[model samples]
Target: MTPSHRSDLLTDALLHYSKKVERKQITLLPQRLAKAAKVKEEARAEFTALLQSVPGTTITAVRGWGEDLVNSLEKTSISLSWEEAYVENLHQLELGRTQLEAPRGGAQVLEVVKRTERARRQVDILERRHRVRQRWSLTTTDSERYLTAAMEKRAQAVLDSVSNLAFERKFMCGLMAKYAEGQTIAKKLSRQIHKLNSKIRRNVKLYNLKRPVIPSSSTLPTLMTFEIAMNPESGLWSQHSVSHDAAFQLKQRLFVLLSLHDRASEEMNIIKRPVCRVRED
Candidate 1:
């Protein structure tokens, strides 16, 4: 019925949810997955190292060939890294869930979990790039190949750069979306806190007038409400209030969320370099 009681109830519920998340995260893959991933990374690195031994790599004729080899290594690295990322993702998820169950651990755990999710999305992009590269390599013509080399001094440069740009754009888009949501929340909380202040001032005015006032039976605000509010945001949220003894955690959560929003905004606003172009011959 009180703020503290509500927090206790929410804590129990969050612990239960965290346990479920832990169970999901602990779902194991075949033992061979880790070993295969390690071996693939090592092999890719070794092949990349072998590039230094290939002669005439600087020459146009040989450069394309070298590019092909380098691309192959990159593709392998992308594929292997994408697959291996899940291992850490799941590990971090479990760790995050454990932390989520602990007192006042929500902010840190949410950060870790959201980061793992971001890593997974990056892998998704890599997977798509690998597919696109494979498709293009099959269809590239001699003229296109020449243009590629002339524009960037490496046949694969355009492809790699295009892929990188695509990835960056996608990442920026994601940040923009997050920033929008954070802005909305910051506005909402600012309003709520403002409203609370107004209510407190009115209460004081009423008490000073010596008017008999009936207190509302509704439970007071709690840190748990912040968690409820942040359910959609799902990253770095703490249900526990920021204090020597926890009471109102939403203010702290809002501060961090707004800060994150500002950082994303700055990144989104940066000017990107122009894409390489080939002049008509």
Candidate 2:
């Protein structure tokens, strides 16, 4: 082939590649975004489950706060999606309006042909008047102009809504991150409480600690110790609803019960030591 012919071939190849790339982007961008959204939704669901599975008695206040934040995040995501749809529909309407024209005379060529011709004429007039680009389309009526302006305003509003939703999502994420440490502590403490309760259930009854006669009428003091174990009154415990203080309080209560058991058993050696003591450095 001649050099000029090769250059023409290269130019055609470049155009074909550019078109292919454009089509690929159009096809992939939405799919990629959808996959990302799905992943985000799954992550949020998992986070929600984590918050839910956290023992309520453990992190009563913190759990409530986390759940509220998750709900707010979900609402923001939903609102953002709705606004995106609205913007897309309005853009389609704007494009459709530009592509449509008024009906023309009934002739042998048909109404469609007449309308096409009329649209072409309108475009020519608009191009001469406004020096528009090639492939430009216009609507030259007062109503159409007003509708276009309204669509533009609606688009702007949608943009603002999107911005607000984004900020809300960021804020919710930040709050969740900030509270993560507290949740972790709550989760760990809750597990420890569960284990301790099991241990106390097995061991507390073994000792002749004053068994609440009429077990139906009276709560097992040992069982009730679990309530004090949660220790909702203490600042740290109330703040997180689960903490070291709650666990320590439970241990203290258990020790007192055991000490009484030791006294009753005539195990004076066991009673010689302090029931439960915290060492100071």
Superposing every Cα of model 1 onto the true structure, what RMSD results?
A: 34.7
Winning candidate number (lDDT): 2
Reference-based TM-score of each model = 0.18, 0.20
For residues 3-23, write the lDDT of model 2, one tens digit per residue.
Answer: 999999999999999878766
Candidate 1 collision pairs = 241-248, 241-249
How far residue 226's Cα lies from its native spot in candidate 2, in Å, is 44
Q: What do the candidate models score in CA lDDT, each in turn?
A: 0.38, 0.41
133-210: candidate 1 lDDT, tens digit per residue: 432221245423332223222212222332322222333344455445568765665555455444434433433222
TM value for model 2: 0.20
